[model samples]
Target: MIDVYLFSGFLGSGKTTLLKHMIGQVKAQGLKPAVFMNELGQTNFDSDSVDDGVPLKELLDGCICCSGSEKSEAQIQTLLAEETFDVLMIETTGAAHPVEALDAIFSPLFAERLNFKGIITVADSKRWLSRDELSPQIRSLFLEQIRHADLILANKMDLLTEGEQAKTIFELQSLNPAAQIIQTVHSKVPFKQLEKTTAKKSDDVVKAPVAKLNLDTRVLRFEAGVKRERFEEWLRTLPDTVYRIKGYVPLEGDKYPHAFQYAYGMAQWLPEYMKMQPQIVVIGEGLEGVELP
Candidate 1:
């Protein structure tokens, strides 16, 4: 089984920035973990922030509410089947309902391989008060995000004054009586703090039973040695339908294992999990065959 951590926060609430900071400890600990991100556009910084040592995976371009959640779950399963990872951290889009992630993780296909660690939310100390006062939708979402969190990161503490900080902390405590409210600036915390399991005393554990999302799907998994020249040709010939590709292969005489991936349209390569299995996943429009190696 793998440890799964779900992180939720409002847009611009510093989830990405804080996640980046936490990943620094992940690198320092020498604990290589795989990160999955589901977002609106194609841009993500989770993978780029690390020291090119920690392997990161992304599922972007579509929100989890769309076909991306299924695709993301499938990719995670295939990865676990190939190489065992120490942990998996997932960051949902700001607009995504936390229950949707809970449903996806607890589903039949994924439940067997992973277990829930905890849910975390990053709240902006300065803007949250006004957000709650002005926009009811934002307030509801914020409360929902915090209510489910095992940890509430009072991020952006640098922006709040001394008095505002105390009031913000008190308000968060009132809103989420169960979560451990911690003051943090820029997601600064030790790896143990984020990974440690917390006790649950409250009954409201975010069980938003949701209908299973049905998906018409397909898969292809295979291994074929490419002549050095054929390697570049194969890479260039990749169809646009290929949503993601990940695995370890010798790009040049086995000097270094080349682990790479393509999400949406952007792709990157990093040497990792050299001794593990060779695997990759491509998801997109009109998929049908399940080719196996």
Candidate 2:
């Protein structure tokens, strides 16, 4: 039986970071793993950053919990039929609802062959307390992502004060009393805590919540290599309305393409060898007429 793990969290909550770490751990154990990354727009960065030789599939243009469900189910069936992997890791888009994701995975087609392992949610401590500033719908999305998690990682603890950390934990507990919470910096959670024997079904999660976020995505493509320093400077000064910025950027004088991720005013880059056109996908609410340098 294939053990399956679902990694769910709000955008910029470090789901991709934790998923990469978990994939590395699984590889270290000599176990084969397959990844299904659910991305909101056509552009994908996390899939490219995955270094494992394991088969990776991207469910793009929608979240797996909603519009992408059919495609996601199909991908799972295809993997089960054509590939061999000891485990499967699914990284859902930040806006994805756990209930809908569970419903899609636990469908009759996947019932017998797959063993649901764990639902891990990563929470940004700073973002946690700033929910009130976001639109009501987005705030609900954040809370819903935490509601059904088996393990909730209170990440980015370094940015919080002692009093803020206490309140963050208290709020998280109030939202998800059943989840096991672990505080960490940079979403670094113990690998052993991720493996599990039991799983929860659609009924186990709350009823499927409708997504009301008016998210807009802008895709920018650059055919030529861009100067790393100039790009970095522009990324550092992105508008506050931009919640997520991800893409494959070809840097000048570099043989390999660079993968970039920008969230909450922080930018990260790593050498990525994925053979894809260079483009960036910026996602956020109220992004109309937004220009990027």
Best by TM-score: 2
- What is residue 140's positional error in candidate 1, in angstroms? 1.8
RMSD of 2: 2.5
Worst 10 residues of 2 by lDDT: 196-205
lDDT over C-alpha atoms for residue 34 of model 2: 89
The lowest-lDDT stretch of 10 consecutive residues in candidate 1 is: 212-221
CA error at residue 201 for candidate 2, angstroms = 5.9
Model 1 lDDT per residue over 1-293, tens place: 77788889765566766677766666577766767776654544344454565556667666664467787777666666666667777888765667656656666876877867888888867666566352444456666777778888998788778998999999889988878888988677666877775634335564543333221223233354435466545656655444344444455445445665543334456765435444444443334543432
Backbone clashes, each candidate = 0, 0
